[model samples]
Target: MASLNRIWGLIVKELLALLKDPRARVVLIAPPLVQLLVFGYAATFDVNDVRVGVLNRDGGELSRRLVAGFSGAPAFHVTRHLDQIRQARPLLGDKKVDMVLHIGPDFGAHLHRGRAARAQVLVDGRNSNTAAIISQYAGSIVAAFNREALGNGGDAELAIRAWFNPNLVSRWFIVPGLVGVLTLVVTTLVTALSVAREREAGTFNQLLVTPLRPPEILLGKALPAIFIGLAEASVIVAFAVFWFGVPLAGDLRLLYLGLLLFMLSTVGMGLLISSLCATQQQALLGAFLYIVPAIILSGFATPIANMPETVQDLTLLDPLRYCLVVVRGVFLKDLPLELLLPQLWPMALIGLVTLSAAGALFRSRLG
Candidate 1:
C-alpha cells in the first residue's frame, strides 16, 4: 500500500512538472496539432490538377475527341497546345507541363481499319511516383476514348473498384497513420526527457535516497507518459474522423485498447533510452534515432511487403508497425478483435520485453 502511494505521488509530481510550464504545454499541444494539419493537407499520394500539354499532328475528328477527353478529366488540365513535336521539349524541360500528349498522324488511319492505335505520352519522370500516377490517368483517359469511339470493340473493359476508401482519397490513408505516428513521437519524447531532466536538475539523487523502489520509480515515470500519449492519440483520432472526414469504421473500444498497448511499448522504449542518456540532449537525439527507423519500418509511408526479406524480418520487432495495422484497420476496416489479435499480441509482447529491460537497466544504473 505504501509503495503504491509513493508511486502515485511520483506520478502526480511528474504530471505537474510536465503540465505546469507554459512552454511545455505549448510543446505538448501545438506541434502535434500543427503536424497533423500539415501532414493531413500536404502529404498525399493522390495526384490532382496535373498540368499537361498537347501536341497534335493529326488534324482528325478522332484526335480532337481525344484532346477533349483529356480536357474533361478532373485530374488533368490542358495547359498548352503544341503545334510541333519540338515544342513539347521546351515545355517538358522548363517544367511547365507534367506530360505532353502527342497524337500521331496515323492515329485515325489505324482506327478506321480496326488496327491498334498508339498515342505517345511524353511524361516528366522527375518524380517517379507522380509520373506513374499521371501515366495511369492518361492511360485511363485513352481507354475511355477508345470505348466511346469503337463502341466497345477495341479491348475488354476492366472494372476497378476500390474498397474501404471508395474514392481512394489519400487523406483517408495518411491521417489514420498519423494518429499512431504523432502519438509515438509525443509519448517517446515526454518519457525520454523525464529521467534526463531529473538528472540535469540534480534531483535524480534525491529520489534515490527516498524509500521508492526502482520499479515504483519507473512506474511513476511511465504512467504520466502513457496518459499523455493516449490523450494525444485521442486528439489526433478526433481530428481524423471529424475534421478530416475519415470514417471511424471500427469499434472505438478496440481502437483505444490497441492504442493502450502501443503507448506501453513506446513509453517502455522511451524509458530505456532515458536511462542510458546522461543528458536531455542525448535523450532527445536518441529518441529521434529510434523514432525515424521505427516510422520507416512501420509501413507508414511505404508498404512493408515491398521491403527486402531481411528488412521485413526486422520490422517484426517494431511496435509501431503493429500499431499502424491496428490503427488503419480500425479506422478503415472495422477490424474485429479476433482480426486484431495478431497485431495486439506483438505490441503487448514488445511492451512486456521493453518494460522489463528498462526496469533491469534502471536497477543496474542505481547499483
Candidate 2:
C-alpha cells in the first residue's frame, strides 16, 4: 500500500511538472496538430492544376479537337496557345508553363491518311517524380484520344483498377502514416527528455532517495508519456478522418491495438535515450538523430522496396516501419488480425527489449 501511494505521488509529480508551465502545455499539444494539418496538404504525390501551353500548326478540326481534350483535362490547365514553335521557346524559358504540346502541320493529314500522327511534348524535368506523373497524364490522354478516334472496334484495352485507394489520393496514403510518425516523435521527445531533465535539474538524486523504487520511478515517467502519446495519436487520427475525410475502414479496436504496441515501443525507445543522456540537450539531439532516419527508413515518404536489399534488411528492426504498414492497413485496407499479428509481435518484442535495456541503464546510472 505504501509503494502504491508512492507510485501515485510520482505520477502526479510528473504530470504537474509537465502541465505547470504554460509554454510546455501549449508545446505539448500544438505542434503535433499543426504538423498534421500542414503535412496532410503539403506532402502529396497527386499533381493537379498543371500549366500547359499548346502550339498547333494544324488549324484543322482534328487539331482543335485535340487541344480541346487538353483544356478539358482535370490535371491540366491551358495557360496559352502559341502560333509558332519559337513562341513556345519564350514560354518555356520564362517558366510560364510546365509543359508544351506541339502539334505539327501534318498531324491532321497523317491521321486522315491512316498514318500514325505525331506530336511532341516538352516538359520541365526539374522534378523527376512530377515529370514522370505529367508524362503518364499526357500519355493516358493521348492514348484515350487515339482510342476515341479509332472507334474502339478491335483494339484491346488495359482496364486498370486500383484497390484500397481507388482515386489514388496521396492524402489517404500519407495521413494515416502521420499517426505513427507524429506519435513516435512526440513520445520519444517526452520520454527522452524526462530522465535527462530530472538529472540536469539535480532532482534525480532527490527522487532516488525517496520511497519510490527505480522500477516505480521509471513507471511513473513512462505512464504519463504513454498517456500523452496516446492522446496525440487520437488527435491526429481524428483530424485524418474528420477534417481530411480519409476513410477508416477497419475495426477501431485493431487500430488502437496497433497504436498501443507502437506507442510502447516508442516509449521504450525514448526511455532508453533518456537513461543514456546526462543532459536534456543531448537527449534532444539523440531523439532528432533517431527520428529523421527512422522516418526515412519507415517507408513513410517512399517505398521500402525501392531501397537497396541491405537497407531494406536493416529496416526490419525499425518499429515504425511495421507500424506504418499496420496504420495504413487499418485505415485503407481493413486488414485482418492475422495480417496485423506480424507487425504487432515485432513491436511487442522491440518494446520488451528497449524497456528492459532502459531499466538496466537507469539502475547502472543511479548506482
Candidate 3:
C-alpha cells in the first residue's frame, strides 16, 4: 500500500513537472500536431498533374485523337507540342516537362491497315519513382485508347482492383502509421528525459534517499509518459480519421489495445535510455539515435520484404514495426483481435524484456 502511494505521488509530481512549464507544454502539444499536419499533407506516393509534351508527326484524325487522350487524363497535362524530336531534348533537360509522347508519321496508316503502330514515350528519369509512375499513367492512357480504337479486337483487358484502399490514397497508408510514429516519438522523448532531467537538476539522489524502491520509481516515471503518449496518440488518431478523412475500419477497442502494448514497449525502451544517460543533452541524442533506426526498421516508408536478409532479421526486435502493422491493419484492414495477436505479443514481449532490463540497470546504477 505504501509502495503504491509513493508511486502515485511520484507520478503526479512527474506530470506536474512536465505540464507546469510553458515551454514543456508547447513541446508536448505543438510539434506532434505540426508534424502530423506536415506528414499527412506532404508525405505521399501518388503522382499527379504530370506535365508532358507531344511530338505528333502523324497529322491525321486518329493521331489527333491519341493526343486528345493524353490531354484528357487527370494525371497528365499537355504543356507543349514539339515540331521535331530534337525539341524534346531542351524541354526535358531544362525541366520544362516530365515526358514527351512521340507518334511517328505512319501511326494512323499502320493502324488503318490493321498493323501495329508504335509510339515512343521519352521520360525524364531524374526522379525515378515519379518517372516510373508517369510511365505507368502514360501506359494506362495508351491501353485505354487501344481498347477504344480496336473495338474489342485488342488483347484481353486486365481488371485491377484495390481491396482495402479502393482509391489507393497514400494518406490511407501514411496517416495511420503516423499515429504509431508520433506516439513513439513523444513517449520516448518524455521518458528518455526523465532520469536525465532529475540527475541534471540534482534531484535523483533525493528520490534514492526516499523509501521508494527502484521499481516504484521506475513505475512512477513510466506511468506519466504512458499517459501522455496515449493522449497524444488519441489526438493523432482523431486527426487521421476526422481531419484527414482516413476511415476507421476496425474496432476502436482493438486499436487502443495495440496502442497500449506499443506504448509499453516504447516506454520501456525510453526508460532504458534514461537510465544510461546522466545529462538531458545526452539523453536527447540517445533518443534520436534509437528513433531514426526504429522508424527505418518499422517498415513505415519502405516495405520490410525489400530489406536485405540480415537487416530484415534485425527488424524483428523493433517494437515500432509490430505497432505499424497493428495501426495500419486496424485502420485499413479491419484487423480482428486474432489477426492482431501476432503483432501484439511481440510488443508485449519486448516491453517485458526492456522493462526488466531497465529495472536491473537502474538498481546497478544505484549501487
Candidate 4:
C-alpha cells in the first residue's frame, strides 16, 4: 500500500511535468486519435474484393452462375479472365490476381448428373496465407451455391449466429480492438522514445541524479502514457458509437478497467523497450517489430485457433492478444465475469510480470 501510494505521488508529479511540456502533451493526446482513425479503418486484414482471375472454359449456365457469385460479393473480385491455362501463371506472378478459378469443360454436365461439380482454383503459392484464406472464401461461396443449386441442407456440428453484429462488420471487430491496439502503439512508441530522447539531450543524467527512486522515475516516465492510452480509448469509443454505430454492450466502468490493466502492460512494455535500447532508432525499430507481429497474431487479423498449437501457446505471453479478447468480449459478447476471467487474468498477470521486469530494467538502466 505504501509503495503504491508513493508510486501514485510520483505519477502525479510526472503528470504535472507532462502538462508543462507542450511537446509531450501533443504526443500524449494527438497521435492516438489520428492513428486510431487511420489504422483502424485502413489497416484491415478482412480484405474485401481481392482481385480474382477466371478461366471459364465451360461457358455454361453453371459457370456463369459461379462466376457471377464470386464476383458479386464484396470479398471476392473477378476482373480478368484467362484465355488459356498458361495465362494464369503470369497474372498471379505479376500479382494481377490473387486466385485463379478454372471451370472445367464438363462443369455443367457433371452438375446435371447429380454429381458434385468440381472447379479447380489455382492460387499463387508464393503467398500461402492469403492464398489459403482466399481458397476458403472461394470454397465457401461455391459450397453455398452447391447447397442452393442442388437444394441440400443438413445438420452441421456448429451453428454460428453472430449477435450484435449480424453482418460481422470488420469495423465492429476492428474498431473496438483498435481502441486498445492503436493506443498501445502510440503510447508505447511515444513513451519508449521519451527516455532515449532525454538521454540523447543530456536530460536523463540530470534526472537520474535527483532524489527520486528508480521506481518513482519509472512511474513518472510511464505516467504520461497512461493519459494518452486512456484518451485514445475514449476517442475511439466515441468514434465507434457515433461513426460506426457499434453498441457498447457492457458497463463503461469494466471497459475502462480493462483499458487501464491493458495499458499498464503496454506502457510497461514500452518502458522495457526504451530501457533496453540506447538509441531512438533502435527503440522505434524494436517497437515496430513488436507492434506488427503482435497485432497480426493477436486474433486481430486471424483467429488464434488457425495458428499452429505451438504458436498459439506462445501467444499466451502476448498481452495484446488478451487485451483484444477483453475488448471483443466486453463489446460484442457482453461477457460477464465467467467469460471475462480467462481474458482478464492473463492481462493482469502479464501486466504484473512485464511491469516488474520494466521496473527492474529501469533501475539498472538508470544506475
- Per-model TM values vs. the true structure: 0.62, 0.61, 0.61, 0.59
User: Candidate 1 — worst ten consecutive residues by lDDT sum?
Assistant: 154-163
Q: For residues 177-278, could you state the per-residue lDDT of candidate 2 as single tens digits?
A: 899999999999999999999999988988767788778888898999989988999999999999999999889899999989988898899999899887
Q: Rank the candidates by lDDT, best first.
A: 3, 1, 2, 4
List of clashing residue pairs for candidate 1: none
The C-alpha local distance difference test score for the whole of candidate 4 amounts to 0.73
Q: How accurate locally, in lDDT, is each candidate? A: 0.80, 0.78, 0.81, 0.73
Q: Is candidate 1 or candidate 2 better by TM-score?
A: 1
> Taking the candidates one at a time, how many backbone clashes does each contain?
0, 0, 0, 0
Give lDDT for model 1: 0.80
lDDT of 4 by residue, 59-101 (tens): 9887798888889877777889888988986676445776788
Q: For model 3, how does the per-residue alpha-carbon lDDT over 1-367 read when each residue is reduced to its tens digit?
A: 9999999999999999989978568657865665564344434556666788898899897788888988999878899999988998668644577778888898887777777788888775433445557778877988888888665243312232233554557787788989999999999999999999999999988876789898998899999999999899999999999999998988999999999999999999999999988899778977876887788778787555445566678789999999988888788767788878989999999999999999998898775
Task: Name the runs in model 4 displaced over 4 angstroms.
Answer: 1-161
TM-score of 1: 0.62
